[model samples]
Target: MHIVYPAVVSALLFSIGVYGVLARRNTILVLMSVELMLNAVNLNLVAFDVWLRDRLHAGQVLTLFVIVIAAAEVGLGLAIILALYRNRRTVDLDRLRLLAETPAPTGSTSVPGAVSPPSSGPGEGP
Candidate 1:
Protein backbone atom coordinates (compact mmCIF):
# COMPACT_ATOMS: atom_id res chain seq x y z
CA MET A 1 0.00 0.00 0.00
CA HIS A 2 2.75 2.43 0.97
CA ILE A 3 4.76 1.55 -2.14
CA VAL A 4 1.82 2.13 -4.45
CA TYR A 5 0.87 5.40 -2.83
CA PRO A 6 4.36 6.89 -3.03
CA ALA A 7 4.83 5.72 -6.61
CA VAL A 8 1.61 7.35 -7.73
CA VAL A 9 2.45 10.57 -5.92
CA SER A 10 5.88 10.65 -7.49
CA ALA A 11 4.45 10.12 -10.95
CA LEU A 12 1.99 12.95 -10.38
CA LEU A 13 4.76 15.25 -9.28
CA PHE A 14 6.81 14.38 -12.35
CA SER A 15 3.90 15.10 -14.67
CA ILE A 16 3.26 18.45 -13.05
CA GLY A 17 6.91 19.31 -13.43
CA VAL A 18 6.82 18.49 -17.12
CA TYR A 19 3.79 20.69 -17.63
CA GLY A 20 5.40 23.60 -15.83
CA VAL A 21 8.62 23.31 -17.84
CA LEU A 22 6.80 23.29 -21.17
CA ALA A 23 4.16 25.89 -20.39
CA ARG A 24 6.28 28.49 -18.61
CA ARG A 25 8.63 30.79 -20.53
CA ASN A 26 10.35 32.47 -17.63
CA THR A 27 13.81 30.95 -17.13
CA ILE A 28 13.42 30.95 -13.39
CA LEU A 29 10.10 29.12 -13.57
CA VAL A 30 11.60 26.54 -15.87
CA LEU A 31 14.42 26.04 -13.42
CA MET A 32 11.99 25.58 -10.55
CA SER A 33 10.10 23.03 -12.58
CA VAL A 34 13.29 21.14 -13.22
CA GLU A 35 13.96 21.06 -9.51
CA LEU A 36 10.48 19.70 -8.94
CA MET A 37 11.12 16.90 -11.41
CA LEU A 38 14.38 16.05 -9.69
CA ASN A 39 12.63 15.93 -6.35
CA ALA A 40 9.98 13.63 -7.75
CA VAL A 41 12.62 11.23 -8.95
CA ASN A 42 14.28 11.38 -5.57
CA LEU A 43 11.03 10.56 -3.86
CA ASN A 44 10.51 7.56 -6.09
CA LEU A 45 14.02 6.33 -5.45
CA VAL A 46 13.71 6.57 -1.70
CA ALA A 47 10.27 4.96 -1.72
CA PHE A 48 11.49 2.01 -3.74
CA ASP A 49 14.51 1.63 -1.51
CA VAL A 50 12.30 1.48 1.52
CA TRP A 51 10.02 -1.11 -0.05
CA LEU A 52 12.84 -3.41 -1.10
CA ARG A 53 15.20 -5.13 1.29
CA ASP A 54 18.39 -4.00 -0.33
CA ARG A 55 21.84 -4.99 0.88
CA LEU A 56 23.13 -1.52 0.10
CA HIS A 57 21.39 1.86 0.16
CA ALA A 58 21.78 2.35 -3.57
CA GLY A 59 18.58 4.29 -4.12
CA GLN A 60 19.29 6.67 -1.27
CA VAL A 61 22.82 7.24 -2.53
CA LEU A 62 21.54 7.95 -6.02
CA THR A 63 18.99 10.37 -4.59
CA LEU A 64 21.78 12.26 -2.86
CA PHE A 65 23.67 12.52 -6.11
CA VAL A 66 20.56 13.80 -7.87
CA ILE A 67 20.10 16.50 -5.25
CA VAL A 68 23.71 17.63 -5.54
CA ILE A 69 23.57 17.80 -9.32
CA ALA A 70 20.26 19.66 -9.22
CA ALA A 71 21.72 22.31 -6.94
CA ALA A 72 24.66 22.84 -9.28
CA GLU A 73 22.39 23.03 -12.32
CA VAL A 74 20.15 25.66 -10.72
CA GLY A 75 23.19 27.71 -9.74
CA LEU A 76 24.65 27.65 -13.24
CA GLY A 77 21.30 28.23 -14.94
CA LEU A 78 20.50 31.22 -12.74
CA ALA A 79 23.90 32.72 -13.44
CA ILE A 80 23.37 32.37 -17.18
CA ILE A 81 19.86 33.92 -16.98
CA LEU A 82 21.21 36.77 -14.89
CA ALA A 83 23.95 37.48 -17.40
CA LEU A 84 21.47 37.40 -20.27
CA TYR A 85 19.10 39.75 -18.46
CA ARG A 86 21.94 42.18 -17.76
CA ASN A 87 22.99 42.23 -21.40
CA ARG A 88 19.48 42.48 -22.83
CA ARG A 89 17.70 44.41 -20.04
CA THR A 90 14.76 42.00 -20.21
CA VAL A 91 14.02 38.43 -19.17
CA ASP A 92 11.04 37.72 -21.40
CA LEU A 93 11.75 35.11 -24.07
CA ASP A 94 10.04 37.09 -26.82
CA ARG A 95 12.08 40.18 -26.07
CA LEU A 96 15.26 38.14 -25.87
CA ARG A 97 14.73 37.05 -29.48
CA LEU A 98 15.31 40.67 -30.48
CA LEU A 99 18.94 40.04 -29.67
CA ALA A 100 19.16 37.68 -32.63
CA GLU A 101 17.35 40.07 -34.98
CA THR A 102 19.67 42.99 -34.26
CA PRO A 103 23.18 43.11 -35.63
CA ALA A 104 26.27 43.53 -33.56
CA PRO A 105 27.26 47.03 -32.54
CA THR A 106 29.19 49.04 -35.13
CA GLY A 107 32.61 50.42 -34.41
CA SER A 108 35.61 51.91 -36.17
CA THR A 109 37.31 49.60 -38.68
CA SER A 110 34.40 47.22 -39.32
CA VAL A 111 35.11 44.21 -41.51
CA PRO A 112 34.41 44.73 -45.22
CA GLY A 113 30.91 43.56 -46.25
CA ALA A 114 30.28 42.57 -42.66
CA VAL A 115 28.31 45.60 -41.48
CA SER A 116 26.87 48.68 -43.14
CA PRO A 117 28.52 52.04 -42.57
CA PRO A 118 26.94 54.92 -40.67
CA SER A 119 24.23 56.80 -42.65
CA SER A 120 25.82 60.21 -42.13
CA GLY A 121 28.90 61.35 -40.30
CA PRO A 122 31.83 63.89 -40.52
CA GLY A 123 34.68 61.79 -39.06
CA GLU A 124 33.38 58.24 -39.69
CA GLY A 125 35.83 56.36 -41.89
CA PRO A 126 35.85 52.68 -41.08
Candidate 2:
Protein backbone atom coordinates (compact mmCIF):
# COMPACT_ATOMS: atom_id res chain seq x y z
CA MET A 1 0.00 0.00 0.00
CA HIS A 2 1.13 3.55 -0.70
CA ILE A 3 2.00 5.86 2.22
CA VAL A 4 -0.67 8.28 1.07
CA TYR A 5 -3.42 5.87 2.05
CA PRO A 6 -2.56 5.73 5.75
CA ALA A 7 -1.59 9.40 5.75
CA VAL A 8 -4.95 10.43 4.36
CA VAL A 9 -6.80 8.16 6.77
CA SER A 10 -4.83 9.61 9.67
CA ALA A 11 -5.64 13.14 8.54
CA LEU A 12 -9.33 12.30 8.28
CA LEU A 13 -9.31 10.73 11.72
CA PHE A 14 -7.66 13.79 13.18
CA SER A 15 -10.17 16.13 11.52
CA ILE A 16 -13.09 14.07 12.80
CA GLY A 17 -11.63 14.11 16.27
CA VAL A 18 -11.20 17.86 16.18
CA TYR A 19 -14.75 18.32 14.98
CA GLY A 20 -16.08 16.09 17.72
CA VAL A 21 -14.18 17.94 20.41
CA LEU A 22 -15.34 21.31 19.17
CA ALA A 23 -18.99 20.41 18.62
CA ARG A 24 -19.89 17.94 21.36
CA ARG A 25 -21.36 19.15 24.65
CA ASN A 26 -21.35 16.00 26.73
CA THR A 27 -18.23 15.39 28.81
CA ILE A 28 -17.96 11.72 27.84
CA LEU A 29 -18.15 12.58 24.17
CA VAL A 30 -15.40 15.15 24.59
CA LEU A 31 -13.18 12.56 26.23
CA MET A 32 -13.97 10.12 23.44
CA SER A 33 -12.98 12.79 20.93
CA VAL A 34 -9.67 13.30 22.69
CA GLU A 35 -9.13 9.55 22.54
CA LEU A 36 -9.92 9.61 18.84
CA MET A 37 -7.34 12.33 18.30
CA LEU A 38 -4.74 10.30 20.20
CA ASN A 39 -5.56 7.22 18.11
CA ALA A 40 -5.11 9.27 14.96
CA VAL A 41 -1.68 10.31 16.14
CA ASN A 42 -0.84 6.68 16.89
CA LEU A 43 -1.94 5.67 13.41
CA ASN A 44 0.27 8.33 11.86
CA LEU A 45 3.20 7.30 14.01
CA VAL A 46 3.00 3.62 13.07
CA ALA A 47 2.28 4.34 9.42
CA PHE A 48 5.33 6.59 9.12
CA ASP A 49 7.47 4.08 11.01
CA VAL A 50 6.52 1.38 8.50
CA TRP A 51 6.93 3.67 5.54
CA LEU A 52 10.45 4.65 6.60
CA ARG A 53 11.39 1.04 7.39
CA ASP A 54 13.31 2.20 10.43
CA ARG A 55 15.35 -0.48 12.22
CA LEU A 56 14.82 1.16 15.63
CA HIS A 57 11.05 1.46 15.11
CA ALA A 58 11.04 4.49 17.38
CA GLY A 59 7.72 5.71 16.02
CA GLN A 60 6.07 2.44 16.88
CA VAL A 61 7.60 2.51 20.35
CA LEU A 62 6.32 6.05 20.87
CA THR A 63 2.92 4.91 19.70
CA LEU A 64 2.92 2.35 22.50
CA PHE A 65 3.77 5.07 24.96
CA VAL A 66 0.93 7.21 23.63
CA ILE A 67 -1.48 4.29 24.08
CA VAL A 68 -0.39 3.83 27.68
CA ILE A 69 -0.75 7.53 28.40
CA ALA A 70 -4.14 7.61 26.71
CA ALA A 71 -5.29 4.71 28.86
CA ALA A 72 -4.25 6.50 32.01
CA GLU A 73 -5.91 9.70 30.83
CA VAL A 74 -9.17 7.90 30.11
CA GLY A 75 -9.16 6.28 33.53
CA LEU A 76 -8.69 9.58 35.32
CA GLY A 77 -11.00 11.47 33.01
CA LEU A 78 -13.84 9.00 33.50
CA ALA A 79 -13.39 9.07 37.24
CA ILE A 80 -13.74 12.86 37.22
CA ILE A 81 -16.77 12.71 34.94
CA LEU A 82 -18.46 10.16 37.18
CA ALA A 83 -17.91 12.30 40.21
CA LEU A 84 -19.25 15.35 38.39
CA TYR A 85 -22.33 13.45 37.22
CA ARG A 86 -23.04 12.36 40.76
CA ASN A 87 -22.83 15.94 41.95
CA ARG A 88 -24.55 17.74 39.06
CA ARG A 89 -26.75 15.05 37.41
CA THR A 90 -26.11 16.18 33.82
CA VAL A 91 -22.80 16.06 31.91
CA ASP A 92 -23.43 19.00 29.61
CA LEU A 93 -20.27 21.07 29.33
CA ASP A 94 -22.05 24.42 29.14
CA ARG A 95 -24.10 23.74 32.25
CA LEU A 96 -20.96 22.72 34.10
CA ARG A 97 -19.26 26.09 33.72
CA LEU A 98 -17.52 27.01 36.94
CA LEU A 99 -17.81 30.76 36.45
CA ALA A 100 -21.45 30.89 35.42
CA GLU A 101 -23.69 33.16 37.40
CA THR A 102 -25.94 31.52 39.95
CA PRO A 103 -29.66 31.83 39.49
CA ALA A 104 -31.49 33.98 42.02
CA PRO A 105 -33.44 32.21 44.73
CA THR A 106 -37.21 31.88 44.18
CA GLY A 107 -40.38 32.80 46.10
CA SER A 108 -39.24 34.43 49.30
CA THR A 109 -40.30 38.06 49.22
CA SER A 110 -38.89 39.98 52.19
CA VAL A 111 -40.31 43.18 53.55
CA PRO A 112 -38.00 46.04 54.28
CA GLY A 113 -36.55 45.82 57.86
CA ALA A 114 -38.13 42.40 58.36
CA VAL A 115 -35.99 39.73 59.98
CA SER A 116 -36.07 36.19 58.63
CA PRO A 117 -36.77 33.34 61.00
CA PRO A 118 -33.88 31.06 62.03
CA SER A 119 -33.68 27.36 61.19
CA SER A 120 -35.06 24.85 63.74
CA GLY A 121 -32.25 22.32 63.42
CA PRO A 122 -31.13 20.08 66.26
CA GLY A 123 -28.94 21.48 69.09
CA GLU A 124 -29.95 25.02 68.30
CA GLY A 125 -31.35 27.42 70.92
CA PRO A 126 -34.90 28.65 70.26
Candidate 3:
Protein backbone atom coordinates (compact mmCIF):
# COMPACT_ATOMS: atom_id res chain seq x y z
CA MET A 1 0.00 0.00 0.00
CA HIS A 2 3.02 2.28 0.30
CA ILE A 3 3.31 4.91 -2.46
CA VAL A 4 7.00 4.16 -2.84
CA TYR A 5 6.30 0.66 -4.13
CA PRO A 6 4.34 1.73 -7.18
CA ALA A 7 6.56 4.77 -7.77
CA VAL A 8 9.71 2.67 -7.89
CA VAL A 9 8.16 0.04 -10.11
CA SER A 10 6.86 2.70 -12.46
CA ALA A 11 10.27 4.31 -12.64
CA LEU A 12 11.91 1.01 -13.53
CA LEU A 13 9.34 0.25 -16.19
CA PHE A 14 9.75 3.75 -17.64
CA SER A 15 13.52 3.39 -17.75
CA ILE A 16 13.36 0.09 -19.59
CA GLY A 17 10.89 1.60 -22.04
CA VAL A 18 13.25 4.50 -22.72
CA TYR A 19 16.09 2.10 -23.42
CA GLY A 20 13.94 0.03 -25.75
CA VAL A 21 12.83 3.10 -27.67
CA LEU A 22 16.36 4.45 -28.02
CA ALA A 23 18.37 1.26 -28.62
CA ARG A 24 16.06 -0.85 -30.75
CA ARG A 25 16.42 -0.73 -34.54
CA ASN A 26 13.10 -2.39 -35.30
CA THR A 27 10.05 -0.11 -35.60
CA ILE A 28 7.69 -2.62 -34.02
CA LEU A 29 9.88 -2.86 -30.94
CA VAL A 30 9.92 0.90 -30.73
CA LEU A 31 6.11 0.97 -30.67
CA MET A 32 6.09 -1.59 -27.85
CA SER A 33 8.49 0.58 -25.90
CA VAL A 34 6.14 3.52 -26.21
CA GLU A 35 3.35 1.35 -24.87
CA LEU A 36 5.56 0.38 -21.93
CA MET A 37 6.16 4.03 -21.14
CA LEU A 38 2.44 4.73 -21.26
CA ASN A 39 1.76 1.84 -18.89
CA ALA A 40 4.33 3.21 -16.48
CA VAL A 41 2.48 6.53 -16.47
CA ASN A 42 -0.82 4.76 -15.85
CA LEU A 43 0.66 2.88 -12.93
CA ASN A 44 1.93 6.07 -11.36
CA LEU A 45 -1.41 7.77 -11.84
CA VAL A 46 -3.28 4.97 -10.06
CA ALA A 47 -0.72 4.81 -7.25
CA PHE A 48 -0.93 8.52 -6.58
CA ASP A 49 -4.71 8.42 -6.79
CA VAL A 50 -4.89 5.76 -4.13
CA TRP A 51 -2.31 7.49 -1.99
CA LEU A 52 -4.09 10.85 -2.03
CA ARG A 53 -7.55 9.50 -1.24
CA ASP A 54 -9.22 12.29 -3.16
CA ARG A 55 -13.03 12.33 -3.31
CA LEU A 56 -13.08 13.28 -7.00
CA HIS A 57 -10.51 10.62 -7.98
CA ALA A 58 -9.09 12.85 -10.70
CA GLY A 59 -5.90 10.83 -11.00
CA GLN A 60 -7.78 7.63 -11.77
CA VAL A 61 -9.98 9.45 -14.26
CA LEU A 62 -6.91 10.81 -16.02
CA THR A 63 -5.42 7.34 -16.04
CA LEU A 64 -8.48 6.11 -17.90
CA PHE A 65 -7.97 8.87 -20.46
CA VAL A 66 -4.35 7.83 -20.84
CA ILE A 67 -5.38 4.25 -21.44
CA VAL A 68 -7.80 5.33 -24.15
CA ILE A 69 -5.15 7.46 -25.82
CA ALA A 70 -2.63 4.64 -25.60
CA ALA A 71 -5.05 2.31 -27.33
CA ALA A 72 -5.56 4.78 -30.18
CA GLU A 73 -1.80 5.30 -30.45
CA VAL A 74 -1.20 1.58 -30.77
CA GLY A 75 -3.79 1.29 -33.50
CA LEU A 76 -2.30 4.20 -35.49
CA GLY A 77 1.26 3.07 -34.90
CA LEU A 78 0.63 -0.42 -36.23
CA ALA A 79 -1.04 0.97 -39.33
CA ILE A 80 1.96 3.19 -40.04
CA ILE A 81 4.41 0.33 -39.43
CA LEU A 82 2.46 -1.92 -41.77
CA ALA A 83 2.43 0.74 -44.46
CA LEU A 84 6.17 1.29 -44.12
CA TYR A 85 6.86 -2.44 -44.25
CA ARG A 86 4.82 -2.78 -47.41
CA ASN A 87 6.58 0.11 -49.09
CA ARG A 88 10.15 -0.65 -47.92
CA ARG A 89 9.90 -4.45 -47.39
CA THR A 90 11.47 -4.09 -43.92
CA VAL A 91 10.74 -2.16 -40.72
CA ASP A 92 14.34 -1.64 -39.68
CA LEU A 93 14.83 2.01 -38.64
CA ASP A 94 18.34 2.16 -40.09
CA ARG A 95 17.16 1.07 -43.54
CA LEU A 96 14.46 3.78 -43.38
CA ARG A 97 17.17 6.46 -43.54
CA LEU A 98 17.21 6.12 -47.29
CA LEU A 99 13.60 7.33 -47.46
CA ALA A 100 14.98 10.85 -47.18
CA GLU A 101 17.63 10.39 -49.88
CA THR A 102 16.87 11.01 -53.53
CA PRO A 103 18.89 8.75 -55.78
CA ALA A 104 20.71 10.28 -58.74
CA PRO A 105 18.93 9.31 -61.95
CA THR A 106 20.05 8.95 -65.55
CA GLY A 107 16.88 10.69 -66.76
CA SER A 108 16.77 13.88 -68.82
CA THR A 109 15.86 16.09 -65.84
CA SER A 110 19.50 16.40 -64.73
CA VAL A 111 21.41 14.92 -67.65
CA PRO A 112 24.80 16.46 -68.45
CA GLY A 113 24.79 19.72 -70.41
CA ALA A 114 20.99 19.99 -70.42
CA VAL A 115 19.92 23.63 -70.04
CA SER A 116 17.05 24.31 -67.64
CA PRO A 117 14.48 26.89 -68.71
CA PRO A 118 14.48 30.09 -66.66
CA SER A 119 11.60 30.56 -64.26
CA SER A 120 9.13 33.38 -64.94
CA GLY A 121 9.18 36.13 -62.31
CA PRO A 122 5.98 37.29 -60.61
CA GLY A 123 6.12 40.57 -62.53
CA GLU A 124 6.36 38.82 -65.94
CA GLY A 125 3.03 37.81 -67.56
CA PRO A 126 3.00 34.48 -69.43
Candidate 4:
Protein backbone atom coordinates (compact mmCIF):
# COMPACT_ATOMS: atom_id res chain seq x y z
CA MET A 1 0.00 0.00 0.00
CA HIS A 2 1.08 3.57 -0.69
CA ILE A 3 2.23 5.75 2.24
CA VAL A 4 -0.41 8.34 1.37
CA TYR A 5 -3.17 6.11 2.74
CA PRO A 6 -1.80 6.18 6.29
CA ALA A 7 -1.00 9.86 6.00
CA VAL A 8 -4.56 10.68 4.97
CA VAL A 9 -6.01 8.64 7.81
CA SER A 10 -3.73 10.35 10.29
CA ALA A 11 -4.80 13.74 9.01
CA LEU A 12 -8.45 12.85 9.46
CA LEU A 13 -7.84 11.65 12.98
CA PHE A 14 -6.02 14.84 13.82
CA SER A 15 -8.88 16.94 12.45
CA ILE A 16 -11.38 15.09 14.61
CA GLY A 17 -9.16 15.65 17.63
CA VAL A 18 -8.98 19.36 16.92
CA TYR A 19 -12.74 19.55 16.68
CA GLY A 20 -13.21 17.71 19.94
CA VAL A 21 -10.78 19.94 21.76
CA LEU A 22 -12.55 23.05 20.54
CA ALA A 23 -16.14 21.87 21.02
CA ARG A 24 -15.87 20.02 24.33
CA ARG A 25 -16.19 21.97 27.58
CA ASN A 26 -15.37 19.09 29.90
CA THR A 27 -11.68 18.93 30.87
CA ILE A 28 -11.50 15.13 30.61
CA LEU A 29 -12.92 15.14 27.09
CA VAL A 30 -10.37 17.75 26.06
CA LEU A 31 -7.59 15.54 27.39
CA MET A 32 -9.03 12.55 25.52
CA SER A 33 -9.05 14.59 22.32
CA VAL A 34 -5.40 15.46 22.83
CA GLU A 35 -4.63 11.76 23.24
CA LEU A 36 -6.45 11.03 19.99
CA MET A 37 -4.27 13.55 18.17
CA LEU A 38 -1.13 11.94 19.60
CA ASN A 39 -2.34 8.50 18.44
CA ALA A 40 -2.82 9.82 14.92
CA VAL A 41 0.72 11.17 14.83
CA ASN A 42 2.00 7.86 16.16
CA LEU A 43 0.18 5.97 13.40
CA ASN A 44 1.72 8.18 10.73
CA LEU A 45 5.17 7.73 12.22
CA VAL A 46 4.93 3.95 12.32
CA ALA A 47 3.58 3.75 8.80
CA PHE A 48 6.39 5.86 7.42
CA ASP A 49 8.95 3.89 9.40
CA VAL A 50 7.82 0.67 7.74
CA TRP A 51 7.92 2.20 4.25
CA LEU A 52 11.34 3.81 4.62
CA ARG A 53 14.45 1.99 3.29
CA ASP A 54 16.68 3.17 6.14
CA ARG A 55 17.74 0.58 8.74
CA LEU A 56 17.92 2.96 11.66
CA HIS A 57 14.07 2.99 12.21
CA ALA A 58 14.09 6.62 13.31
CA GLY A 59 10.35 7.01 12.87
CA GLN A 60 9.58 3.93 14.94
CA VAL A 61 11.89 5.09 17.72
CA LEU A 62 10.21 8.48 17.76
CA THR A 63 6.79 6.84 17.91
CA LEU A 64 7.89 4.82 20.95
CA PHE A 65 9.05 7.95 22.72
CA VAL A 66 5.78 9.68 21.85
CA ILE A 67 3.79 6.82 23.36
CA VAL A 68 5.80 6.97 26.56
CA ILE A 69 5.29 10.72 26.85
CA ALA A 70 1.59 10.41 26.08
CA ALA A 71 1.19 7.98 28.96
CA ALA A 72 2.88 10.37 31.36
CA GLU A 73 0.72 13.25 30.11
CA VAL A 74 -2.50 11.30 30.64
CA GLY A 75 -1.49 10.31 34.17
CA LEU A 76 -0.67 13.89 35.14
CA GLY A 77 -3.78 15.26 33.44
CA LEU A 78 -6.06 12.85 35.30
CA ALA A 79 -4.53 13.77 38.63
CA ILE A 80 -5.09 17.48 37.93
CA ILE A 81 -8.68 16.90 36.82
CA LEU A 82 -9.41 14.87 39.91
CA ALA A 83 -8.02 17.57 42.15
CA LEU A 84 -10.02 20.28 40.38
CA TYR A 85 -13.25 18.30 40.57
CA ARG A 86 -12.74 17.58 44.24
CA ASN A 87 -12.13 21.19 45.07
CA ARG A 88 -14.87 22.74 42.89
CA ARG A 89 -17.42 19.88 42.85
CA THR A 90 -17.86 20.33 39.12
CA VAL A 91 -15.80 19.81 35.98
CA ASP A 92 -17.61 22.19 33.70
CA LEU A 93 -15.42 24.98 32.33
CA ASP A 94 -18.24 27.50 32.54
CA ARG A 95 -18.73 26.79 36.22
CA LEU A 96 -15.00 27.02 36.79
CA ARG A 97 -14.97 30.48 35.25
CA LEU A 98 -17.76 31.59 37.56
CA LEU A 99 -15.78 30.30 40.51
CA ALA A 100 -12.78 32.27 39.43
CA GLU A 101 -14.70 35.54 39.26
CA THR A 102 -16.40 35.18 42.63
CA PRO A 103 -14.87 36.91 45.59
CA ALA A 104 -13.43 35.02 48.52
CA PRO A 105 -15.64 34.17 51.49
CA THR A 106 -15.59 36.29 54.60
CA GLY A 107 -13.27 35.15 57.42
CA SER A 108 -11.58 32.65 55.10
CA THR A 109 -7.90 32.51 55.92
CA SER A 110 -7.08 31.01 52.53
CA VAL A 111 -7.90 34.31 50.79
CA PRO A 112 -5.03 36.55 49.67
CA GLY A 113 -6.06 39.41 51.97
CA ALA A 114 -5.85 37.07 54.96
CA VAL A 115 -2.22 36.28 54.28
CA SER A 116 -0.92 39.74 53.46
CA PRO A 117 1.26 41.41 56.12
CA PRO A 118 0.32 44.66 57.79
CA SER A 119 1.98 47.76 56.37
CA SER A 120 4.98 48.89 58.41
CA GLY A 121 6.34 51.89 56.48
CA PRO A 122 5.18 55.52 56.76
CA GLY A 123 2.15 56.47 54.59
CA GLU A 124 1.49 52.78 54.02
CA GLY A 125 -1.41 52.38 56.51
CA PRO A 126 -4.96 53.52 55.77
Instruction: Write model 3 residue lDDT over 1-126, tens digit each, in one string.
Output: 889999999999999999999999999899999999999999999999999988999999999999999999999999888756544557888766542324457543321212222343221135
Which pairs clash inside model 2?
none
Which candidate, 2 or 4, has the higher TM-score? 4
Predicted candidate 2 versus true structure: per-residue lDDT over 40-71, tens digit per residue: 99999999999899899999999999999999
- lDDT (10s digit) by residue, model 1, range 11-122: 9999999998988888788889999999999999999988886679999999999999998998999988876654444566544443233453775443223234344422
Q: Of models 3 and 4, which has the larger TM-score? A: 3
The lDDT of model 3 is: 0.79
Task: Please identify model 3 stretches exceeding 4 Å from their true place.
Answer: 99-103, 108-126
Estimated TM-score for each candidate? 0.74, 0.76, 0.79, 0.76
Model 1 steric clash pairs: none
Least accurate stretch of 10 residues (summed lDDT) in model 1?
A: 110-119
Task: Give each model's clash number.
Answer: 0, 0, 0, 0
Model 2, position 123: C-alpha lDDT score: 18
Candidate 4 segments exceeding 4 Å error: 98-126
Each model's lDDT: 0.76, 0.79, 0.79, 0.78
lDDT (Cα) of model 2: 0.79
Error of 4 at 108 (Å): 4.4
- Candidate 4, after superposition: displacement of residue 109 in Å? 4.6
User: Weakest 10 consecutive residues, lDDT, candidate 3?
Assistant: 109-118
- Sorted on TM-score, best first, the list reads 3, 4, 2, 1
